[model samples]
Target: MVNGTNTSGFGYDSSTHSVIAEPAVWDSYIQVHKEAGKWRNKIFPHYEDLCIIFGKDRAQGNKAKDFAQMEEDANNEEQSEQIEGGFEEQTTENEDSPNIGSKKRKKVDDVIKGITIAANLL
Candidate 1:
């Protein structure tokens, strides 16, 4: 929005011939201007030929969104790589026999036999 003269209550004084803005209106105006300045400072980081140029293209706000997407993709790739690396480490640690637990026979076979019998009855 273009900056306009404040005219939100106080009228012009005849003696000074200058518009006398109300205190509250003036405060609000100053605050708004301050915020606009902040935004301009953030977006337009550089100056070229007295014209403010945005850090990125003003027209392509989509570029910021694309950057966010790329960041998310990078994060996902990092997580996948971490998981694959962990699996690789585990495999290397147990390369000789993958199922080391299966070599040790236990009482679980009797339990499985009982479960199978029960399942057949059902």
Candidate 2:
């Protein structure tokens, strides 16, 4: 015989000094635990793949090699754009200014020559 006030057959029991567990609460907890376990299992493989791809240095996350490759790609793209005449020639109206146009043209030519050499290397 429980000695506390019972509300709809579930309430705090003074004799047991503990709150009765509702069935729905236990069911929800179980469902959440199961879902968490399922997701962990599903994601573990991808995590392992990343570890393999990144190698032992995965923990540091430095990715220096990747960053260097990206920088090289960007430089190559910029060189290509320059070769394609992507930059506009800036002309100064002052006659006293040295031949800026010739200098700029020479710079573009040098970049073109460098890219040509690199292409020949490949």
State the lDDT at 111 in candidate 1. Answer: 56
lDDT of each residue in 1-95, candidate 2, tens digit only: 11235453434434544434466644554476765333221223254345468665543456455655766887788778765653344434144
Model 1, C-alpha of 35: deviation from truth (Å): 15
Steric clash pairs (candidate 1): none
Q: Report the lDDT tens digits of candidate 1 across residue range 13-116.
A: 44544445556665676687775333321222222322343433445655455545765675677668656755665666576565543332234345546755
lDDT of 1: 0.50
Query: In terms of TM-score, which candidate is strongest?
Result: 1
User: What are the Cα lDDT values of the candidates?
Assistant: 0.50, 0.53
- Each prediction's TM-score versus the true structure: 0.27, 0.26
